[model samples]
Target: MNTPFPAIASSSEVRLPTGHHWLYGDLVLPESFSGLVLFAHGSGSGRHSARNRQVAQRLQQRGIATLLFDLLTVEEEHVDLQTREHRFDIPLLTRRMQDATLWAQSQPQLQHARIGYFGASTGSAAALIAAARLGSRISAVVSRGGRPDLAGPVALAAVTAPTLLIVGGADDVVLDLNEQALRVMQCEKELAVVPGATHLFEEPGTLEQVSALAGDWFAAHLSMEHAA
Candidate 1:
């Protein structure tokens, strides 16, 4: 099925470098667009997850495009879930994110636009690592209930893009981790904790808060002009 927003003209699956496969999301031009957002899901979720889908939908409404892809190949997902070997391989996931960023950079549909990363859970670490590697190419970043600490000091310190870290008040451990990571970030950053929300934000109205915070962060930082 296609995205409901008019701005998203079309969407499709893209194969990357033989082993990697991605859902190459495309949004229709709205006379102009702010930029593209690449989504990185947490453990035990995929591109089609309802939670991430909601966030992506909200971003589309605000003139931001999104790419939500499976970080693992079909076989890899099976092995990772079964044996739990490579899913937590932060470096590997970061590399995949970088490849996707490069792929988006080359596409005519997104060529001139800036790029942002929206990461959740373990994917947050991957996103941070990728943002660090991409440097000035990534315009902004947002983490929802993220494990930013997993990215390690080098990746966190290297990220130059403006970053927003959102955590649920009920998620005490993660909240603390985000706080610790924040101290290490050298770039512009903010930490917002949603009251009454849990780790997965399964409570009513909790996910909405995350969506709102993420939307605002990306909107403020993503440039309308691709060349900007």
Candidate 2:
């Protein structure tokens, strides 16, 4: 899809309704975006994550819109820091993600747009579970150094969207876990390993590679003609 590239257009900050709490989201849409991707930030990260924001920007360059939000509220995040409780809570994260997705779909601008997910770290598990439960509504999923294994076997097998799991080759344990999840997934999927990266992809240019890989994946799948 050829597009007139705009670094960014106007975006809005939305308060999404969740059963437990209201989640904050930053929704950015280019003037002529083809799709919308709701981002699920990793454990201990929020809408302000530099890594996710970078990737979201890259997606924007590819003509895709993005919703980067806080999975946990400020109070909950503070509590988690003391208790180490919420960050790894897959079910909690999954439910919040679904709420965010439904909210995006309800938006006038995004209603007709194809939707995808960009998840990192433990957020990947939540993304997978939500995508599985949503079935065809979700068009694609991209996991960056994610823990899809945390989503468990049932969710992995139930997912039908095209999935791409990008892992850091040097992050052996996580790489192994992603591989295991890959084996269980029945969906059209691919595993991309970024050499010389750690779990955080903190190495210079490593994150750029991740953003590029994700941009391509979302661009390829988030299209009206790409059937769910």
Candidate 3:
């Protein structure tokens, strides 16, 4: 399932305008792309998130472009690191992600591409909220070790995009959280557990499994959106 996407190109330090300021990100585009997925890295993570980057690379191989960006500005991140604030602010993150999504949609390379969301950790909450509010603008969603529960029942119930929640088998608490979130969601959804893997999916082959599942899900839904 992992095949090359033709004419791959990337911008490592893209600056996205958020009205208030600019946030940094990396945008990877492949020729004749099927769709674009925006990564919402977990709290404390940014554009350089290794796990997210791996997933993005795998998606690109399957003809999906990806945008990995900082959810917070540099100053905000510095304060968050010291005060442990802003990371769990789901609304704040949601707004920034929305801006990033709109920004990505407006870019020349991504203009005609369907959009999807790939969320990790608390970022999943923001992604769900953004997806719910944006309606058909987001074609699909996938959560890796994410806390979709934090998005709250109202937001979960409103999401229309097909969502897949992936959790590590060994991460009992988060697995349970995803299960509960799944029940509240009204849209097409699924929960996938990676056997013997932990929260970070550091175990060998676990991340690959995650990547494969994500690529397949996006390829199906995003492709359908493009077709429609």
Q: Write the per-residue lDDT of candidate 3 for residues 89-206, one digit (tens) a residue.
A: 8889999999999898888878878899999999999999999999989999999999999999999999999999999999999999999999999999999999999999999999
- The residue pairs that clash in candidate 3, if any, are none
> In model 1, where do residues sit more than 4 Å from their true spots?
1-6, 18-31, 225-228
Stretches of candidate 3 exceeding 4 Å from the true structure: 1-5, 224-226
Candidate lDDT scores, in order, read: 0.85, 0.92, 0.92
What TM-score, to 2 decimals, does candidate 3 have?
0.95
lDDT of 1 by residue, 1-228 (tens): 965444555556666542434433333344356788988889877888799989888887777778888877777788988888876888878888888888878888788788999999999999999999889999999999999999999889999999999999999999999999999999999999999999999999999899989988888888564234
Q: For candidate 2, what is the total of clashing residue pairs? A: 0
Q: Which stretches of candidate 2 lie over 4 Å from their true place?
A: 1-4
Question: Which 10-residue window in model 3 sums to the lowest lDDT?
Answer: 3-12
Please write out the lDDT profile of model 2 over residues 1-228, one tens digit for every residue. 875577667688989999868888888988778899999999988999999999998888888899999999889999998997999999999999999999989988889999999999999999999999999989999999999999999999999999999999899999999999999999999999999999999999999999999998888898666655
Q: Which candidate, 1 or 2, has the higher lDDT? A: 2
